[model samples]
Target chain A: MARLVEVDDAADPRLADYRDLRDVGLRRSLEAEHGLFLAEGEKVVRRAVEAGYPPRSFLMAPRWLDGLADVLATSDAPCFVVSESLAEEVTGFHVHRGALASLRRLPLPALDEVLREARTVVVLEDLVDHTNVGAVVRNAAALGVDAVLLAPRCADPLYRRAVKVAMGAVFAMPWTRLSDWYDALPSLSARGFTTVALSLAEDSEDLEAAVAGVDRLALVLGGEGHGLSERWTDTADRRARIAMSRGVEVGVDSLNAAAAAAVACYVARARSAGA
Target chain B: MARLVEVDDAADPRLADYRDLRDVGLRRSLEAEHGLFLAEGEKVVRRAVEAGYPPRSFLMAPRWLDGLADVLATSDAPCFVVSESLAEEVTGFHVHRGALASLRRLPLPALDEVLREARTVVVLEDLVDHTNVGAVVRNAAALGVDAVLLAPRCADPLYRRAVKVAMGAVFAMPWTRLSDWYDALPSLSARGFTTVALSLAEDSEDLEAAVAGVDRLALVLGGEGHGLSERWTDTADRRARIAMSRGVEVGVDSLNAAAAAAVACYVARARSAGA
Candidate 1:
């Protein structure tokens, strides 16, 4: 059974893992140094634990305890029961969901291990937004993409916001970072994967035509502002676009990166099914 | 040419339209009563202006004026120049984008008018999140969906955050609120459009199959938390789902509303092309 430690003081060092969550830089460095990530709310906490992430500790109000009793029973981690106000004071935001779990970070699987049996994959390049990263993961999971490969600059999928937004998909999906940003797509191509960069370069084919016949597929999506770099666009096996209606030129000429990934994943799934 | 009026005080009465922007209730009431909406950031403000949302005024740091000079020169609206700190003071948040525009809200198109030439339309049902509504609009616009119809309670697409996330697609797309939420889908059906509600109903056909052979398509999406209400799920001509990977039951069972809409729009667009 989990140890129920009642803590009244917001400044307790035991609550350190739960502090200053809104400070992105602090959380990033702190989480990185501690090899820990947080899952917020009851659903995400439950899902994270279920996905085999061992808990370092849990912080929550008394009311949330009853709802999460079953999950708590399975772990011996300390559960710090703080008052709602104290929880807010410590976390720098209202603990609206009333529960948060600080889970130990597992070593990321090797790129080869993740790609070993995968047929369809998404290779994200420089997607810096944490929410976008999580949303993309959720998209991949829903659409049945075999795995996800992150570029070196991609936002941490294990970041608290990403984890919360993903609803624990960051744990459920098979993914790993590419230490070598330059050769990421090239290596995938060498390994018999068709690396299709999602771009609107002149030579680009329509989305459907691009993924039509590929048995092994890897989609490369770039960051929000400028899109895929010229190098990646040139390096990839093919460059394709989710064809826009002609009138899109009026204001929105492009889909957001996460939305593009979702569309591309669906298209890839459809093509694979038909093939 | 626009008149440039320099202001030092954040409390100036003329700046009221740009005040307390972070307060949803305040923004809604202020915007609605004044028949105005705000567009933030250089790009979004530019797009809003280009889309012909006549500005009530433009508030910005002096640095932004030169970049938007050409756009400003074309209008006679007053441009209020304030320091960045003052901009933040009035907006109740850091105006990191350093530019904001309060524009007169044009009368929304009638429901029939929006649907008149639109073969592909999206009907949003009670989506309370501004960003989701904006994103769906962005997707619909990019994918060639003709228009968007919002349920009575759907968040205002012209709401500031929606405008910013959408990159001003809300201004680009033709959308109107449905006064009669319950009967909205049936009305679309009466007009010969196939109203496909994106739902996980057991009998729901795969999205591609649901849209196959259809000419006029209207996709109904639900809110962020609970999905489409029973009324919409039962009232539509057909219910459909984006097929998920079998393993998705481990965590997420569905896509976010905006992602779902994007996938559905892409599928609908493809079907329309094939037909």
Candidate 2:
């Protein structure tokens, strides 16, 4: 059972993993150095624990304890109860979600293992926003995409903001970063997967037509700003686009990365259902 | 033409419209009182201006004035140029986007006018997040939904965050808030439109089947929290759900409001294409 430890100091040493939540660079190095990430709120904390992530410790107000008693009962981690103000002071943001649990991030699964049994997958290239990463993972989980593979430069899906935005979907979805960026699409093709890049290239077919009846498919999406690198667009098995109405004069052109993922995955779902 | 007036003081009265942007409640009251909303960044500011919004004024860094000279040349509003630090002080947040414009809020179009030629429409019910509101609008615009109608309590699509996230699509899209909440869905059905509520009701049909070949359709979405109210679900012509994989045991049941809209709209687009 989790041992309850009462604490009041914002600078407490035991709460190191939970400090400076808003300082991205500091937290990134700290989390990497210590191999940790935070899962906030009762629901997300429960999900993290249920998904087999090891909890190092928890920091929250006293009232949030009872609601999470079952989760605490199963683990021996320390639960540090603090005043709401102290929690805010240490975290550098309002603890509106009410609880924060610092959990150990596991080593990422190998690319081959992640793709072993996956028939349908998503490959994200250089998405920099944590929220978009989380949302795409959540969309994949909901729409039955078998797995996700990220380009090495994509934002960490386990970042606190991503974890919170995804409502703990980063835990449920199977994902890994690709180390070999240069030949990633070709490698997938060699493994009997058809890599389809979501792009606006002239060679691109409409999304539905491109994705129809492909037994094994990898839908590759590009980064937020300039989209897929030219090399990737040239090398993929097929290029596809969600055709948009021409209102660019009134400011309608491309979908945001997360929205695009959702639309593409839904189309994949439709294709999977033979609709 | 907008006259460029340089100012050194952040506290100058001419910059009042650009003040305390991080304070949502204060900005809400202040913007409503002044009958204005802000559009941030160079692209969004240009869009707000081009979408037929009369500009009240603009506050930007000296470096930005040259880039926006074309837009300024087309407007009679004053452009108050200031230093970056001074811009930060007035905005209470980093003016990383380099420009801000206070534009007059145009009178909303009547509900009948918005639906007159909109074959595919999205109705939002009490969605409180500006980002979701904006993303849904952007998705609707891209995926060929003709318009968006909001409940009286839906967050303002013209709010700065929404405008920025929508990539200024809100200005191009036809949208208006429905004054009547209780009979809103029924009114759409009465106007010879299929009123479909995206819901988790037991009677809910799969989204694709529910929306197929309905000449004129309104897809109603609820708030982020509890989803569609029982009243609307009961009154709508049909309750439909995007079928999701059974990963709920791992905390992946519902898609967020924005993702759901993207998926639904993409399906709507495919149906429109006769795929």
The number of the candidate with the highest DockQ is: 1
Worst 10 residues of 1 chain A by lDDT: A245-254
lDDT of predicted model 1: 0.89
The reply for model 1, stretches above 4 Å from the true place, is A272-275, B247-249, B272-275
Model 2: TM-score, first chain = 0.97
Residue-level lDDT tens digits of model 1 in B120-211: 89999989999888888888888888889999999999999898878887877889999998798889999989899989898898888899
Model 2 stretches with alpha carbons more than 4 Å out: A272-275, B272-275
- Chain B, candidate 2: TM-score: 0.97
Tens-place lDDT digits, model 2, residues A1-275: 99999998877899998988999999999999999999999999999999999999988899999999999999999999999999999999899989899999888999889999988999999999998998889888888898999998999999998998888888878899999999999999999898889999999998889889888889999999799999889989999998887446556778888989888887776674323
How well does chain A score by TM in each candidate? 0.97, 0.97
DockQ of 2: 0.70
- Residues B1-275 of candidate 2: C-alpha lDDT, one tens digit per residue: 99889999877898899999989999999999999999999999998898899999999988898889999999999999888998988899898989899999999999899999888899999899999999999888887888999999999999899998898999999999999999998889999888989999999998888888788889899999789899999999999999898466557788889989888887666564222
